[model samples]
Target chain A: MGGSFTVNHLIYLLQGMMWTVVLSALAFALGGVAGFGVMLMRTARTRLLRQISFVYVQLIQGTPLLIVLFVVYFGLGVVGIELPPLLAAGVSLMVYSSAFLGEIWRGCVEAVPRTQWEASECLALTRWQTLVDVILPQAARIATPPTVGFLVQVMKSTSLASVVGFVELTRAAQVVNNSLFTPFLVFGIAGVLYFALCYPLSRWSRSLERKLNVGRRQAA
Target chain B: MKYNFDFASLQEYWPEFLRGALMTLEMTVIACVFGLVIGVLCAIGRRGKRKWLATLCGAYVEIVRNTPYLIQIFFIFFGLASAGLKLPIFAAAVLTMVFNVGAYTAEIVRAGMDTIHPGQIEAAEALGLSTPQIYWDVILRPSLERVYPSLSGQFVLMMLSSSVTSQISAEELTGVANSVQSESFRSFETFIVVAVLYFGMAMMLKFAFHLFGQAIFPRRRRLGTPL
Candidate 1:
């Protein structure tokens, strides 16, 4: 072994934690944009677009995220394009998250009462206006809790980026353990750091779900 | 930028791929069976009158829920080896998956159990059914039937997540893909094939679960709803 675990190792782990957060944020933002398009296609009037989007979601959802990361990382190189690890990781995560978020938002949109759509159309609002002004506002409320819950999943998944040699929290812990030979200590601390990052979001999502249900119950 | 794909080079490795897929299925089956048992027990513990047991179960669920499976696997595989208790990679992978999925299964089972009305349990008691009888027939069976969809979804996710075990060189589908890619130098094509294999496996698993659910839950088949 190189040496025992030290204060410097802790600092390295903390830095890695920051990268994990950054990667999650990047994935969420990119995925959110792509997922919105996917949701629109899924809910759109065009049967072909809906079918295509459905296949895309099914393909992504059925395969493991690790495989997606490998495909992105190596597929780019196969075309003689050398991208950095962070970009590859971010792209794969974006692809993975979009499928899930698309499905989630689709459910939220469908949850909006059909009468609202009819009323919007009855008022001479165009389809885009009906969706933008009326349906989406209602769907957004139903979508918040599950979206936040999925964020916790996104945060935990960033750990897998380490497989592609992205030196995030899990990779940092592995590096520390390689030198220190203290698997329990190093990974234990890393788990605690992940818990710290994810627990608050999980709790917040649960509270949001509860509050949403209570609101629904009162309305009923 | 002329990169012609060469999947012909990978054709010879189809046997290896099949073996890896078989191992993946084996591991998933073992983990699902044991994980469901652990989950049900923990759910019962969580619902029991003992405060410490409930707290311990809750903590187990939260800790596993919050941490990544990759970290959990690393912790289990390397940590056990360090303690001089070396295990085969397959065994370690299964153990890690059992621990990880057990927590999630417990949460799902607990939620299902919560939907069982309290008056039903009282009716069971009035019928003079024993504790185990009440649990098995009245409480557990219906709860499982209700949450069967969620449980199947988790199991399918567990099968996909098994890809993470490849990190420790477990020789599963992903592990086989890594080796094949390195040897053939066709990384993209190798992973593409593996991705399709995974997609097939996921669909197969879903169909199998649906059939199994239909077989086990007669109430669902007869009434067109879970009881």
Candidate 2:
């Protein structure tokens, strides 16, 4: 009865796909907030803050996301706080994404010409005011392309969450494949679904990068 | 409210851990060497005059870039098994990393290649250099030199991603950590040790690449900066 691929399996996979999107959105949102703080700390005036965040980023970036997932999942359990799979996966993804996104945004912020920062200072602007009025607007434009690009990475990486018992797209594929015994057909369909989700974002990121380059040239 | 950590019981597994780390490093080195070769060829194919070859390379890049590597590994490992042509887990893992890193390296190499001035190629042609000679001397060397930093970074990421091969139980560092943790019931401690090992490995690789860069790119070493 379970040997054939069926519409029921497709429907289940579609449902799992929805969870994948939700997890990606959740991770991105949470990581964005934390990563902004990290970016600020890394670029902050205080040497201590900068050093702390620098080490944090290096440590997180060095380790595999899979290990991070296991650490979050089982570490919490060790502390007698058992979380559901989704929460554990989300927390780990947030940690992973924050390190990467923070680094990306730091680059974007630093790309704002040094002259602009000095000019803002010369105008007697406070650091916050300078960041808000003079620096962030410029950095935001540079950040958009990479941020969108990183979203594709995030979406694809959510597949790793399947390992921690989260029934996302990849996990769902595994489940179906277990029943149907068709690795090629099942995983191929899963891969196609992921491509459908990610391809547009990749194209958009490329186009944005091209447009940004063109805009810089025209300005020059 | 309180949990005591015990690493004493895990000390006996040090040899296994060391072996696993060695295996991980071995896989990364093999994949990086082969992947770079494949990547350079694909990058060349992408820019060649043949439409079909370019398109084929383009599709390979896009498909690999867009899909998750986990599924790619599963497709190869399990799909082959289902076909009754089962490969060893180590071979399958290395093949998957090569395929995944190859696409990424092709892109990076292509970007480097794009920055080579068209006039430089024309100059080489004017000097009566053959296509292979021009490619080797005027195109590939400088392009690789320019992209060395990115290539090294990708290779390190490839090393870390190799942890996923543990899913197929390839007995890499992460796989060893998984089993050791389960055996000792000390999951947190085991992962902490493994995480530190990974960090150490990543830093060592970065240092090694920096030194290798100095050795190869004498021009950059003289300037004291990357291109």
Which numbered prediction scores highest in DockQ against the true structure? Answer: 1
In terms of lDDT, the best-performing candidate is 1
> Which stretches in model 1 have alpha-carbon errors above 4 Å?
B221-227
Considering summed lDDT, which 10 consecutive residues are worst modelled in model 1 chain A? A1-10
- Candidate 2 stretches with Cα past 4 Å from truth are B221-227
User: Clash number for every model?
Assistant: 0, 0
- Per-residue lDDT value at B130 in model 1: 98
Error of 2 at B210 (Å): 1.2
In the range B21-64, model 2's lDDT, one tens digit per residue, is: 99999999999999999999999999999999999999999999
TM-score, prediction 2: 0.98
Cα displacement (angstroms), candidate 2, residue A167, comes to 0.2
Residue clash pairs of candidate 2: none
